[model samples]
Structure formats: structure tokens, C-alpha cells
Target: MKKLAFLVLLIVTVLSGTLVGKAIASTGFDAYSMTTHKIENGNLTNKVTDLISFTSQNIENEKNNDSKLVSINNVSDNVIDSSLSTDEEILQELSRYKDLENTYLMQPGWTSITFDQYDLLPLNSPKPLPSQYRKEFWSHFDGNQKVTEQVDYLISSETGKVPLGVFVNGELTSLWNDGQKVKKDPYTPAYDLYLVSSIQTLVESNSPLELSFKQEILANQSVSLIELRTQFSTTDKQWINIQLDKPVWGQYEKFTFNSQTGLLLKYEHYYVLDDMSLVLSSVTDNFEYSVASEAPSDVTNLIATGGK
Candidate 1:
């Protein structure tokens, strides 16, 4: 019983951190769309891979890479082209985040991020929470995650299927189920962004794995798909040492890209951590992006009502 309580506590803490950040300003471009998924893991694994060194000389030699090009003849719309690798695409996206002035999230069916937290410590060891119970427990969450540059918003899927917490310029007011603003948390921060403009340097950006495995398939009526099991890590100059053993927690990502346009249709980001005591945890993010001609009604309505 005590172990279960502890597991709950850890999950609550990390889960809260997974949600929220400043969002891109509204561009009124209904065609832009996105879906963000975050998976939190806290499980240990006995399996290990002695990844290659991140030094310049040890990286993959792409000189004659054209001869080693991976081709899939039976392809469609989901395939990734040979010109750019998956690692390059990911770096491009993260860099795009850096250039964006304002980003937005939590738009119901349109632009929203779904955060799922999981605890995979062994139950007998007073660490691992059973996977079966995680679904239901995590299903009930109150979050204020957005694409903006801050983490002070609130939304609950369990509540009327809308973002109940609304912030206007710098003021937060609670919106009830009837879509009316009411008094809630009356605080907001000044015009300070959390991540985008603060960091001066990208200390290190490295891909830990190269060509561990690859698969080819046809998806979406003809896009060629090249599935790559890749890994990456990045450090920023603004990061301060918090007495953690390894400041760099790498991601084991599975990417599925459309070979034609060099676009990423879907991908999963996984990371693991271990507590001082024998408890190990893992986190994952499943991300999806699309180009639409219009925004969903739910999101449009939310904006129409001043984020009500």
C-alpha cells in the first residue's frame, strides 16, 4: 500500500511537468494543425546498448551513402525520401520551434496535446505500478498545457470537453461548463516567455543511434514509408545542474516519415529514468502533424468564445 502511494506521488509530479508551455500566437491560419502525445515511463530495463560515441569522427560516414540508399518499391504516401534522414527532420522540427514567435495548443479536436503518464516499476519491489491501473488513473487529469511559452493554463478532458481555464492578455478566469467566464485563479505572469527566447546556446544535439533497424511499407494510399529506429538528445545553455546524475536523458524514437515530401506523419519518443532506489521509469511522446485547409469547429468555437 505504501509503495502504491509513492508511485502515485511520483506520477503526479512528473505528469504535471509534461503539460503546459507558451503557444504560438494565433495566425488565423486554419490550415495549420497538430496533435502532441507525451508518454511518461518509470521502468528499469536489464537490456543495454553501448551506443556509439557522440564525437565528430565516430558519426556515420555519409560520403558514399548514396550507394547504400534504402529503397522500397512497393510505396505510397507515407514514405520518407532519401534526400533527408529522419534525424535531420527531427532537428528541423525542433529548430522550427525555436524560430516560432507564438505557438498554441489544446484546441480540442484541432490542435491539442494528449499527455499519458506510465509507471513501470516492479509491483513487488515497491516501485513499479501495474500497467493495467495506469490507464484509468491517468484518464482523470486536470492540465493547462498549451503551445505557448508558459505552463499556467488548465484543461480537463473529463470536464465538458473544452478548455475551462482561459487567460486574457495576462489575466486568468475560469469558464464554467456553460461557456461563461467566472472567478478562478486571477493571476498571470508578465510578458516573459519560458523557453523560446531565453536559451543562448544548444550545448549539444546528438543522435545516439544510427540505422539500428529499418522497415519499409506503403501507407495512406501511396506514400512511401521508411521506418527508422533512431535516438537523439539535446542540451541547452540555460540548463542548470540540479544535482542529477545524468543531465542528458536521451530519447529512443521511432519515426515514420513520408518519403515523398520528407514529412513526418507519426513518431514516438521514449525516455527512461531510475530513482535512487531501484525504481525505473520511462516516458514517451507520440507526435502527429497535418496540413489542413480549415480548423475544427470545436477549436473555432473555443476561440470564438475567447477560449471559453
Candidate 2:
């Protein structure tokens, strides 16, 4: 009985190894250390090469002589083309956020940005309008910044209508709601604009492994997407960081960055449930950016009157 059991286990192990090898071989160049060379005549050559240095001398000899040429094929798009490697594309996207401190600071001139936020519920339940949905506008000019948030909810006597937070040089100066003095403690610096804070930190640290890169079709447009999974830390309320408050079994986030501008186009945060299903906790989208002549008139008036 012992001998029979040993034979069966050995056969199973051998089959598993064979299956894995076949899977690896199916991925083509992605699984092998191969190199493609272009000759002066436009023909191409592919060889199973070592991962280490392939010197200019080798290239010169390959071009000047054909004796060492093992095989040649016509130029094919499926094999090679002029496009940045995946890692290079990731670095290019990261560089966009390297010098960006705020979304409204996309350029030196006056800037304006607007976006909407939605707090989600389990089982994809619907939310009450204006209460669960929020709209925000941020504009910067000269040395002053204005942020206006709109949400309608009544707390006993006070109406949690629109709250206007004003900032100068990136510090929350004052907050007011319809002539009522609102606390500044809750409104941190940059407020909801902190959506990209974690991403900026990851980019600044220059660690590529922490971020996974991919390309996909979103809204019928091509976008470069980056994803990360880890514990989140923030000093104050930020859209993506709030999901950490739960007994999070697992958490991961996906962000799409505009290739040309480096601005965050969209963000989605998900919590992995016990059944390994993803429940979206929050999402922010409808990003708009443009040059502004100045801050909103009402905001400027409030600042001028010293928030009476």
C-alpha cells in the first residue's frame, strides 16, 4: 500500500510541473529572455539572448556581417514596434505628479477645477440626493484660493447647506456657511483635493513595485491605470483614506491619470468582503480643469469683508 501511494504522488507532482511549464511557454517573449535586432535593410532578427549586457560591438558585427545571423523575418507589428515599455510608461505617468502639489495648481496662471463625490452603501443601494452626493469647486488666483462645497443635510436646527472654506498659501483660513461661523478643524488643508495625496507620496518615493500599471478602455477612451493595495494613513479626512475606518478585510484602489496633464481623471476604492467580492465604498469623478480669471465673486467678497 505504501509503495502504491508513493507512485501515485510522484505522478501527480510530475503532471503539475508539466502543466506549469506549458503555461509559461504559452506567454511567448514575456516568459523568455529574448532580443530583437533590426538590420540596415529593414529585416529583423530574433534570438534567445541572455538578460545581461548586449554590447554595441555585437550589434556592429551583426550589421556588418551575415554569417552569424541565425534567422531573419519580415518586420511584424505583433513582434516589435516603437512604443514605450510598460515600466517606462509607468515612470512617465509618475513624473506628472512629481512636481504637482495640488490639482488647482496645474499651471502658473489662474486655475479652476471641479469634481463630484458619492458615498456608497452596501448591496449597491441608492442614496438620497444632495445628502449622499457632494459637489465641489476650487479656484486659485494671485495668492488666494477658494474652495466651495455643496451638500444639503439638516442637523437639528442648523442646515448643513453649502460650506465655503477659504485658503491662502495652502492653509485653511476660515470656513463659513450662509453667514454662520463654521469650524475650521474639520476642513483640513486642501480638503477633498487630497484625493491624489497618496499617489503623490508613492510617486515621490520612486518605488514602482508598490504600483501596478495597465492600459484599458474607459468611457470609450484609452487610459493608463495604476493600482495599489495597502494600509492607508492620513492625518485628516480624505476621500480615499476614509474606507480604512472599517474592519477592512482587504483594500485596494485604482486611479487613472491623464497622460498629458498628470491630473487624476478618476478614482475608485474597493473593500474586499468575506466572500472575496469587491464592494465599492466611494468614488469621485467628473473632473474638469481650466484657467480661471479669478476666484468666485461671492468668495472674493467674503474674503474682502473679513468673513463678517
Candidate 2: worst-modelled 10 consecutive residues by lDDT: 29-38
TM-score of 1: 0.32
Q: What are the Cα lDDT values of the candidates? A: 0.26, 0.35
Candidate 1 local lDDT, 1-308, one digit each (tens): 11111111111111222211121112111000110112233222323221112111111222133212111221233433344445445454434543331222222122333322222212222222222111110000113322221111222344323333333333323332233332223222111121212111121323234422233454332222222222222321112111223332322333343333333333332332232111122221122233222445544454445554
**lDDT score, candidate 1, position 164:** 33
Clashing pairs in 2: none
In Å, residue 203's CA in model 2 sits off its true spot by 8.9
Clashes of 1: 45
Q: Which candidate comes out best when scored by TM-score?
A: 2
TM-score of each: 0.32, 0.47
- Most lDDT-accurate candidate: 2
- The parts of candidate 1 lying over 4 Å away from their true place are 1-160, 164-215, 220-250, 261-263, 272-301
